[model samples]
Structures are given as C-alpha cells and as structure tokens.
Target chain A: MVGLLDYFRSAAGAQKGSASVAKERLQILVAHDRAARGRPSYLPKLEQEILAVIRKYVEVDTDAVSVTYEQEESHEILELNIVLPESSARS
Target chain B: MVGLLDYFRSAAGAQKGSASVAKERLQILVAHDRAARGRPSYLPKLEQEILAVIRKYVEVDTDAVSVTYEQEESHEILELNIVLPESSARS
Candidate 1:
C-alpha cells in the first residue's frame, strides 16, 4: 500500500495543502447529513408554507426569509429570520 | 418588490417546491461559514502536518484520517478518527 506521505507528495502534488478543501467538503457533508437525518422531513415543507402565508402581507425577497433549528443539549430552538425590502422598511 | 409567494410561484415555477434544495444549500453554507469563522486559520494546516506524521507508521487511505473540533457551549472538543488498512490491522 502506498504510504500517506507518498500519496500526499505524489498524488496530492504536495501543493500548499488541500486541508482547507477537505475541511470545506467535510463541513458541507456533515451539515447536510445532520439536517437530513436529524430533522423531521416536514420541517422544510412547513417553512415553505409559512413563507407562503407571510408573503400575503409583505413584499420581500424570498431568500430573505428563513427557518432553522438550533440544538443545545437536550433543548431544540427554532429560529426564523426575514429581511424586509427597503420600500417596506422605509414606510 | 416581489411578494414571496409570487416569486415562488413564478420564479420558482412553483415546481414541487425547492425548499429542500434551499435547506441543503443553506446547511452547507452555514457549516462552511461556521468552520471558517470560528476556528483559527492554522487548524487545517496543523491537521495536515499531523496526518503527515501518522503516515510514517501506517498504510492507510489519506481520506480515512480526519481531525475536527466540536463545540459544546464553552467547551471545545478536538476529535480525530483514523482507519488503518486491513494489511496493517492484520500485522
């Protein structure tokens, strides 16, 4: 088997180090896995529906609305953020 | 400004709903931002150096080794996982 160092030096080109790349990939995979596995599948749907209802009253960027869950020990917190458009904010 | 629902129905084509896609992308971005912002810049480099040293003794897939820091309130946990090749395990 090729040693890790040899693989690094040869296959990896020993370039400045791809550790940041690996970390980035790992972070993404971990977050997706955590979200997909830990939350009820309906959460995202519920958020969308909530966004739908909220739209009836406000003119805003769709991307400005969000819903998320935060876990802390045995407690779970649901968080929402919405950014109003400048026209609405001004008025 | 586009109301959220109109934007969703038109821009998003009201296609089955891309809430899941948005959630997935959000999760990835959150993880990356958290990792990049919370940690010192040197952590990834240190992990690579440690991986280099470990390679001297074992034949293993480079990807099999990992280092991560987990947060729990004020406490920080550094975690490492390494899987050795079957040949090395047998010997």
Candidate 2:
C-alpha cells in the first residue's frame, strides 16, 4: 500500500512539473511579444552616450556604467548607474 | 542699427528656446502616460527579493543594488547590478 501511494504521489508531482514548464513557456512568449512591440529605438545609443559622458570624469570598465529605461504609468524613468572603483588615494 | 538686429536675434533665440521647452514638456507628458499604463506589478517585489538573496552572502548598501527590466526584439532582459564595496583584504 505504501508503494502504491508513492507511485500516485510521483505521478502528481510530474503533472505539477509539466504545468510549471507550460507556464514558463507562456511567459517567454509574452515577453518576446512585448520586446518586439514596445522597445524604444533610442535606448542603445542613449546608453552608449551616457557611458561616454561618465568616462570623461572617471576611469571605469566598460561594464561599470548601466543605463536603464523603464516606462511607468505616469512617467518614464531613465536610470543611470555608475560604479566607481574605490580609490587607493583615500586613507 | 546693430541694436535693432540684436533685438531680432534675441527674439529668434527666445522662440527657439521656447520650442525646446515645449518639446521637453511633451516628452514628460508621454513618459507619465506610459508610466501609468504598463509597469509590471511584480517588479518592486522582484527587486526586493533579489536584494534579499544577495544580502545573505555579502554586506551591501540598500542603494547598491539596481534591478532593470528591459524588453528587446527577441527577448526580455531582467538585469540586476550590484556594486560590491572594495574589500580591504584584497591587495
């Protein structure tokens, strides 16, 4: 009887696993659609320009600058983040 | 007269400045509308969860983590950036 119950539990777990897989696939599809439809044309150039501007002031890796554009319901936020390396000059 | 020409030039400059100002206002309005319409409900929670997960291993400032969600043509990118403080242990 224990063996039989274990088999049923395994079957239910497998079903739940497949349901999660389907959900993941659907999310990917929706994300792809949104990407194709709504991305701004200026984003890449804007990021590059921002990186260049920051480079004028500090020595940083190419990856140290990040620019993100997010659209919100009442406003769009263009966020720029720069990670500066700790200066050895500081005691 | 040079003064008369200067006055006309100033008038033209004012008009141009006002045109740029109007453009800025329109951009702000459009941003507001987009912000109001389409931000994902899960974004803030997702950011907080990510920050918590990272904090378990490393000590970091609250502002040191940035989460950005960007949709592209073929994929959606959820970017998490963490600025780690320079470890004094490192030579």
Candidate 3:
C-alpha cells in the first residue's frame, strides 16, 4: 500500500537522505516553528477546529483537546491529544 | 516485522494521542532542542563520526557534511546535509 515510506522513497530517489533534502525539510519545519512562537491570533480557530473534529464522534472536554507540533533530530511530528470525560451518568 | 509503527503503537496504546503523551514527546524533543542551540564544543567530534560513516561507502568532500538543528513551532528537526564531488579523475 502507498504510505509515508512510499512517499519518502519517491521523494528521495537515489539521493535518499541527501543534504539538500534535509535542508529543505528543515526550512519548512523552521518556518512553521517561527510562526507558532507565540500564542498567535489563530490559535483559537485552530483549537475550535480540532474540537469540532473530535465532537463528531463523542462528547469530550473541549479544553482537553490540544494540538501541537514537535521536532527532534529529523523527526517532525504533529501531535494531537484529546481527553474525554468518564462514562458516569450526569446528575 | 517490528518497525516504527510497532514501536509507536507499543509506546502509546489507549492514550495514543493524549495530551500527556504530547507533553512527554515535547519534553524529550525540546530537551534535544535546547542542547543543540549552540554549536556546542563537541560538534567537531560529531562531524568526524558522521564523516566516518559516510566514508565507509564512498569518498566524499569531508567539508560537505553539515549537521544542524532547526526548530519551528513544536517541530524540532536534526538536519544533516552532505555534498560529494563528481566522478571525474584527478589530474
């Protein structure tokens, strides 16, 4: 099946793990990093969008859904965390 | 076969995308981030190690290999780029 590995293979070709590809990836990652330095005005909109996506399946603590990015040594990750309330019945 | 997917699945089970996981990942990524902020005195040693790995395969421009860290938003990337000379014979 076509997946991330396939994409990487097609993207890198014979120059897999080349310096140029690394630099390009870094440039993109850094650009996103710089944009998210502060709380930023669009944070609310983003949060709402995430909440909406989660709300579609089940009720959840809106505040519990957090969307963030993370990077470490060539690993650029988009992290999403959501928490739902206990299954107890509401009074 | 055991791959990254297996590793990630094992690492995060029911709380695969939970905020706590996000925070943990961020902590680890950021630690690496802060450590790489400066050129760091050990850069030369790292370069030598990397050059040695590449040298095992082909002769390359020792100066061409560059290692750098980039941070964006929540993305931290370890970027490594190397350039090699052409195949032309030396005079």
lDDT of 1 by residue, A7-88 (tens): 2123223323544543221111101112223334333433444344434434547666555554422222233455544333
Report the Cα lDDT for residue A44, model 2.
Answer: 39
Quote the lDDT for A35 in model 3. Answer: 15
Q: Tens digits of per-residue lDDT for model 2 on B1-91?
A: 0122223223334444333222111010000001122333333333454344334434556666554454422223344444445430112
lDDT of 1 by residue, B3-90 (tens): 2222212322332244454222111110111222333333243344434443444454766655555442212223345544433421
Top of the candidates by TM-score: 2
Model 2 lDDT tens row, A1-91: 0122223223334444343222111010000001122333333343454344334434456565444455432223344444445330112
**Predictions' DockQ, in order:** 0.07, 0.02, 0.02
List model 3 lDDT by residue over B1-91, tens digit each. 1132333333334343443322211101110111122223222333344345334433456465445544333223343444434431122
Report the C-alpha lDDT of model 3 over A48-70, residue by residue, as the tens digit. 44344334434556465444544
Worst 10-residue lDDT window for candidate 2 chain A reads: A24-33
Better of 1 and 2 by TM-score: 2
The best candidate in terms of lDDT: 1
Please state the i-RMS of candidate 3.
Answer: 19.3
> How much does candidate 2 score in TM-score?
0.25
In candidate 3, position B91 carries an lDDT of: 29
Worst 10 residues of 3 chain B by lDDT: B24-33
Candidate no. 3 TM-score: 0.22
Reference-based TM-score, model 1: 0.24
